[model samples]
Target: MSEHVDVLIVGAGLSGIGAACQLRAGHPGRSVAVLEARDVSGGTWDLFRYPGVRSDSDMFTFGYRWRPWPSETALADGPLILDYLRTVAEERGVDRLIRYRHRVVSAAWDSATARWSVVVDHDGVESTITCDLLWGCTGYYDYERGHRPEFPGEESFAGQVVHPQFWPEDLDHTGLDVVVIGSGATAVTLVPALAEKARHVTMLQRTPTYIIPQPDRDPLAVALRRLPERVRYPVVRWANVLKLVANYQLAQRFPAQARKLVRRLAEKSLPSDTSYDEHFQPPYDPWDQRLCVVPDGDLFRALREGGASVVTDSIETFTPGGIRTTSGRELAADLVITATGLELKLFGGIEITVDGEPLVASETMAYKGLMLSGVPNFVFTIGYTNASWTLKADLVGDYVVRLLDFMDARGLRTVVPVREDAVGERPFMDLQSGYIQRAVAWLPRQGDRAPWQLKQNYFVDVRTIRRGEIDDDVLAFT
Candidate 1:
C-alpha cells in the first residue's frame, strides 16, 4: 500500500506555515502535510546564525497577515524572527503537521487519476508519496549553500573565509581584523556588527549599494500599542503597507531625486574624509536594486567612530596578509567574510513532470507569480522583491485556499492555469540584483498581461488575488 496525501506542501518556512494556516482557517476539513527539507522548522532563520542577520523589511508587513506576532520592532534579529515563526506554527498547530528531514525529490502528475506521485528523500532512504495537489513553498534559494565566487589567489590569503549563509557558530572575530566583501544587505549588516567586537572591519565592495537608516522602534506600533489587537494590528499593518508602496512609487518615478536624497543622507552620516562619490555612489538608479537599511545609522556610526571602513574597488587577488585591490591597495585582515549572495534555486530543486513529460520551468509562464501555466493542481510562491516577502506570500496563500474552495464546490479534481493569448515575456524578477540576474535565465518567465504578470504592488495584488474571481478564463477546471 502506498501512502498518499491530498495536499502536500513543501518547506516549513514562513510561506509554508502561512499556507497551512490559511488552509486550517479557511478550509478546516482539508488535509495538508508540510514537508521540511531540514530538521528544523524555521527555514532561513534557523539556517542563518550570523552575528547580525536581521530583516531589512519592517516586521509589520513581513509577518503573516492571518496572525501578527507580538513584537513590533521595526527591524528584528534573525533569532527573534525565527522564534516568532516557530511560535506561530505551534500556536496554530501547524508544527504538528510538519515532517522534517523529508526533502522532496520530484513530483509527477497523472491526469488520468488526477494525483501526483511525489518522490521524497527521507533520512537518505528514498520514499514515494502521492498527492492530489502539490504546493511548493521551498522559496527561491538553495538551502545547502549560497553563491560563493572564488576570488583570485584566495588559497594564498592564509585567513579564515566565511560565508554568511553557513556562518560557523564557534567562529570568533573578537579582537581580529575582518574584511567583508560585497555591499549588499549582508555586508552592511555585518560591518557594524563585526566592528563591535573585532579590532577593525573593512567592507570591500566592487560597487556601492544605496544604504539608508530607519528607526529601530516602529512609530505606529509604539503609538498604537494602547489600542486593542484587532484595531492596532490592522491599522499599523495597512499604514506601513501604504507607506512602503508610496516610497517605492516615488523612487521609481523620480529616481534621480531619490538618489540625491540618499546621497545627502549618506553624506551627513559619513565622515567628511570619506568620498561620497567614490565610496557611496552606485552606477544604477534608485530602485534598480534594493536599498539596504541600517537601523539607527549603525553602519555610518561605526565608520565615523573608526571601528569599520569601506573600500570601493575591484579585487585583483588575495594576498597573504589581506585582499589586494585592482588599485594595488592591500587591506590587511585576520578574517575574510564573503557576503556575496544567495544561490537561487526554485521548488527545492524538485523535478516536475506532467503525464511523464518533463516540465521545463524556463519554458512556462508564471500565472499570477503563484502558479505555472499548463501545470495542474500545482501552485508555487515567489514573494514581492521590493516589499515584505510575507505581504505577497499571504496573498498567495489566500489564492490557493480560494482555488481549493472553488474546485471543491464544483466537484472538480484538478485546476490548471492555461494562457491562450500571445504576450511578451519578461524575467521572473524585476530587480537587477546580482543573484536574480544570475538565475533569471533558468527561472520561469512572466507575461505582460493581467493574470499572467505580477503587478508587484500589494494593493493591486490584494484586489486581484484576494477578492478576484477564481473561475477566470485563464484557469481551466476539471
Candidate 2:
C-alpha cells in the first residue's frame, strides 16, 4: 500500500522536529509525516551512551529559538537533551505524526505528477509512500557504524578493545588501565570521566587539538531565569551569539594573537611542570577545526591530579596488551577505546533520482545552503560547523515554510535552482578536519558567490534566509 502526504520529513531528530513544528504552525492545512529510522526520537543523543556524553556547544544557542530552555546550565548532558527533545515533540503533537523504524531507501521525483515516490524499509517489510515535497533532516554522519581505522596488529591485542559508538553496557573499566585514542571532543570528555573509575586514563593523539574551558553554569542565565520566559530567552540567546561571533572574528583577523590567548588560558589550567605547547597546542589555527570545550576544566583537573595523562604520537601497531607508537614507545592498557571520529554520510545514504535520472551530489552546487541546484521540491537542513548547529537549523525550518507558502500562492507545482553562468567551485566545507577531507569527493560543491556558496556565519545566514527574497531569477517555478 502507498500512503500519500502533502509533505514528508526524513529523520525525527532536532532538525526534523523543529521543521514539523514550523510547518504545523505556518500551514496547518498541509498534511505532514516524519520517518525516523531509529526507534527513538532523540537522534544523536539517543545513539551515544558513552561516559560524560554532552554537547560541546552551549545550550542557549544550541537549543531551538522558539522555545526557551528551562535549565540555566549552559552545557547539558545527553539525558537532559533527550528529555528536552521529547518534550518538544509531545507538546507540539509532532510525536504522533512520526513513524519509527521507517528508513528511507530511495526517492524519485516525477515532473509529470509533481510528486516524489519514496521507498522505505520498515523492519523487514518494504513499503511505498508518495509526497508532494521531501525534506531531509538526517544528520551528516553515518549512524549505523562510526568510522574505525584499521590497526596493523589489532587482533594481536589481548586487552578488551571498544569503540565509543558501540560501547557495551556490561563492560567494566573500573581499576583498569585505559587508553583513549584521538584528541577531539569525545576523547577529551572520555578521558576525564574514565579517570574517575579507571586506575589511569591516557589520551593518545596523532596531532593536537585546541581545547578551552567553558563555565558549566552561566551566571547571566541564572540571573535571567528569574524573569519571564519571553524576556529572558532572547536576551541570553543574543548575548551568547554575539560573544561567539566576536571571538570567531578575532581569531580570523588576528590568528597569532588569538592563538597566544588560547595557549595562555590552557596553560593556566594545567600543572606548572606540564608543557602546554607539547600536547595542547594544535598545528592549525583556531577555528580551522572546531574548538573542543571542556566544562569547568575537568580534563585539565584530571591531568593535574595524576588521574589522566596524554601522549602525542602516531600508532605503529597494537601489541599483546597495548599499542606501540612510531616512536617505539609502548603504553600498557587493560582497555583500549577508539574515539577517533565520525564518517560523513549525505542524506542518510539514500539515493535520489529526478525524472528517471540519477542525481550526483558532487555535480550539483548548493543553493542558499538549503536546496541543491536542479533538484526540484527538495530541501536539506545542514548546520554551521563553527557555531551551534541548531542556530542555523531553526532558520532553515523557517525558510522552508516560507518557500512552501510562496509556491502555494503562485499555484506552482515544482521549483528548482538554475545556474545562469559559470561560477568557481570549492569544497562544501572549508574545514581542514580529517572527517571532512575524507568525504570531500562524496559531498556537494559550493560556488564562490552568495546564494550558491555556503555562508557558515549564523548572522549572515539569518539576514539572507530569514528576510531575503524568494522570487529570484535563479529559482525557476513551474
Candidate 3:
C-alpha cells in the first residue's frame, strides 16, 4: 500500500528540514513527509568528518532566518552546525516527519490524478508514496561519492591517499608530512588544520585561489549579547550580509582593482619571502569561482610559522616518497590528500517521468530558480554560491509558502512553468568551476531574460522571490 501526503520532501538536510517547518507553520492543513537517504540529519555537516571542517561563510547569514543563530563565532565548526540543524528539526517537530534510510529511486507524475507516485528503497525493500507536491531538497552534489580524478602513478605512492570528502575518522595526520592537492576551499581549509599536528603541510595547486581573511568571531554579536536573540541576531546578520554583498559586487564591477586588493591583503598576511606573483596571483578575475575565506588568517599564520607551505605547479605523477610536479619538484609526503572537488548531481539522482515521458533536465529551463519548465507541482531548493546559502534558501521557503497558499485559495491542483520558446539558454550555474563544467550536460538550462535567469545576487532574489508577484503569465495553473 502506498502512503499518501500533501507534500513529499526528499532529504532531511538543512534545506529539507527548513521546508518542512515552513510548510507546517504556513499551511498547517497539509501533510508532509521528509525522506532522508542517510540515517542522520544535517546532510553535509554530518557527512564531512575532516579536521577543522567549518562554514566557509559566516554563520549569521548562513543560519536560518526563522531560528536566529546563537553563536558569536562567525565560522562555526561542523559539529556545531549539525547540532543547530538537529535542534531546529527537533524543536519544530520536523524530526518526526523524517523517514530515515528512505532513498527515493524514482518519481512518476500521474496526470489523471494530479499526484506523484514516488518509489523509495530502504533496507532491500521498495515502498511507494503518493503526494500532491514533490520537493527535491537533496542539494546539487552527489553524496554517494565526490569528484576523484585518477592521478598519474598514484598507485606507486608509499603514503596513505585520502580524499577530504570521505575522510576516515580513524586516519591520523600526526607527525606526518602531508601534501594536499587542489586550490579550492577544501584544500585551503585542510592546509592549516593539518599543519596543527603534522610535521609539515603543503597545499599543492595548479592555480591559486582568491583567499580572503575573515574574523572567527563577530564582534557585534559578542557586544550585543545582553540583548535577546531576536533583537541582536538580525543586527549582526544584516551587517555580515551587506559586507558580503559589497565584497562580491566590488569584485564583479572592478575585477582588476579587486584582484590587486586581494593579492595585497594576502601579501600582507603571508611571509615576506613568499612570492605574490608566483604563488598568490590567479589568472582569472575574482568571483569567477568562489573565494576561500580563512578565519583570522589562520592559513597565512601557518605559512608564517613554517608549519604549512603553498606550491603552485602541476602534478606529473606520484612518486614512492611523494608526488613529482611538472617542474621536476618532488613534494615529500607521508599522507597525500586529494581535495579535488565535488560531483554535481540533481535531485538526489532520482529518475523523473511526467505522464510516461522521461524528464531530460538539460532540455528544461528553470522557473525563477525554483521550479522547472513543464514540471508540475515540483520545486527544488538550491542556494546561492556567491553569498551564504541559507540567505537564498529562507527566501525560497517564503515564496513556496505563498505559492501553496495561492494555490489553495484558487483550488489549483497543478502548477507548471510554460517555457518561453524565444528565451536563450545558459548553464544553470554561472560559475566557471570544474565541478559545474563537468555536469553541464546533466544540469538544467537558465534563460537570458527575467524570471528565467538564475540571479546570483541575494538582494535581487529578495525582491523577486520574497516580494514579487507569484501569478505571472509564465506559470500555468490547473
Best by lDDT: 3
Which residue pairs of candidate 3 clash?
none
Cα-based lDDT at residue 344, candidate 1: 91
Q: Which ten residues in a row have the lowest lDDT in candidate 1?
A: 64-73
lDDT of 3 by residue, 1-478 (tens): 8999999999999999999999888988899999999988999999998888899999999999889997899998899999999999999999999999999999999989999999999987999999999999999999988999999998898999998889997998999999999988899889999999999999999998889888899989989999988899989998989988999999999999999989888889989888888887888899998999999999999999999999999999999999999999989999999999999989999999999999999999998889999999999999988999898888888998999989989999999999998999998998888999999887899999989998788888889998999898998999
Model 1 earns a TM-score of 0.98
lDDT of 1 by residue, 54-91 (tens): 99999989988878758768999999999999999999
lDDT of 3: 0.92
- Residue 387 in model 3: lDDT: 92
Q: Write the per-residue lDDT of candidate 2 for residues 70-106, one digit (tens) a residue.
A: 8888889889998999999999999999999999999
Ranking by lDDT: 3, 2, 1
**How high is each candidate's TM-score?**
0.98, 0.98, 0.99
Between candidates 1 and 3, name the one with more favorable lDDT: 3
